[model samples]
Target: WDAAYERELQTFEDIGDTGEIWFGEESMVRIIRWLERHKVPLDSSVLDIGTGNGVLLVELAKSGYMNLTGIDYSPSAIQLSERVREKEGMSNIKLKVEDFLAPSAELSGFDICIDKGTLDAISLDPDDAVGKRKQYVRSLSSVLKPEGFFLITSCNWTKEELLSEFGEGFEILEELPTPKFCFGGRIGNSVTALVFQRKKAKPSILDKLD
Candidate 1:
C-alpha cells in the first residue's frame, strides 16, 4: 500500500489492474442500503478497518454519516487517506495509523465496523497466518460495541469459511448478493459480502450471583 500510494494512485485499481474494486460503485450502494435497512443511525460511530485510501469513509460522509474513523497500519496509506479526505473537503473524518492486530484502548467502542479485503491480505502473511488471523478477530471484537454491526467484503474466502471464522463472537444478520458466474453448470459468487451483529456476552456464574 505504501508503494501503491507513492505512485499517487486514487483507488486500489490505479496501482495495477488488480481489479480489487471490480464491484465498482455498486459495492458502496449496497453497503449504504444495508446500513439503512438495519436502521443504523446517521450519527453512529463507524470504523473502517484497513481503510487503504479512505474511499469508503468519504462515501459514508457524503451519505450523511457523521462520525467516521479510518485506520491503516501503513503510514503511507494514512497519508494518502488524509490527502484524499482533504481533497474531498471532509476534515471531520478521522484517519489513524494503527495496527488492527495490536491492542489499543483508544480504538474501542465503535457502533459499526467495515472491512474490505483486509482479512484476505492478512491471511496471505507467510509468518504465523493463523495466529495473526485470530489476533485480528480479537482486536476487532474488542473495538466494536456489543451488538454492533460488522460488515465485511471478501473475494478470497467462501461464505462458509467466513461464517466459521466469525461464528464465535458474531451472528449473521444478512448476506448481500454479489455477481455470480456459472462454472461447470454450478453458480458461484466471486465476492462475499456479509453483515454480522456482535453477540452480547453472557454473564458468568459469579456475575449472575451478584
Candidate 2:
C-alpha cells in the first residue's frame, strides 16, 4: 500500500493527475451533502483515516469544518497532501504520516470519522488480512469518542457485509442509497456508503445513583 501510494504521489508530481480522489467527486460530494442534511456539527473533530491527497479534508474545509485531520501511512502521500493544502491556502486541516493500524496517542478523541476506501484495501491484503482488519477497526473505534459518527464508503463490500463487519460497539444509522442499475432483473449498486454511530455506555445502577 505504501509503495502504491508513493507511486501515486510520483505520478501526481510528474504529470498532475492525482488519482487520490479514489471513487469520484460525486461520491465525496454525496457524503458531504448527507452530513449537511443531518446538520452534523461543523465544529466536531473529524479524522479522515487513509487520507491520500487530502482532497476530502479540503472539501470539509470548504464546507466550514474547522477541526479536521487526515492520516496516511505513506510519507509521499502526506507530502502531496500538504502541498495540496498549501496550494489551496488551507491551514486548518492537519495532515500526518501515520498508520491507522498503529496510530499514535495523539490521534484520539475525534467526534467524527470518515473512511473512503481504506477498508477495502485492507481486506484485499494477502497476509493476515482478517487480523489486520480487526486491528484497524479497533484502532478506529479507539480514536473516536463515544457516540461518534463513522461514515464509510466502499465499492468492495455490500451493505450486508459492512453491517456484519461493524457491530460490537457500532450501530448502523443508515446506508446511503446509491444509483442502481438493473442487471438481469436484479438491482445492484456499484458502491456503498454506510453511516454508523458508536454506542454509548449504559449507566449501571450504582453509577446512576451517583
Overall lDDT per candidate, in order of appearance: 0.86, 0.89
Indicate the worst ten consecutive residues by lDDT in candidate 1: 13-22
Could you tell me the TM-score of candidate 1? 0.92
lDDT of 1 by residue, 1-210 (tens): 677655544553254321234247677788998988878899999999988778888889998999999998988788777877877899999999999999578999999999988999899999999999999989989999999999999998999999999999999998999999999999999999999999999889999899
Off by over 4 Å in 1: 9-23
Q: 40, model 2: CA deviation in Å?
A: 1.5
Q: What clash pairs does model 1 have?
A: none
Give one clash count per candidate, in the order shown: 0, 0
lDDT of 2: 0.89
TM-scores, one per candidate: 0.92, 0.92
Best by lDDT: 2
User: RMSD to the native, candidate 2?
Assistant: 1.8
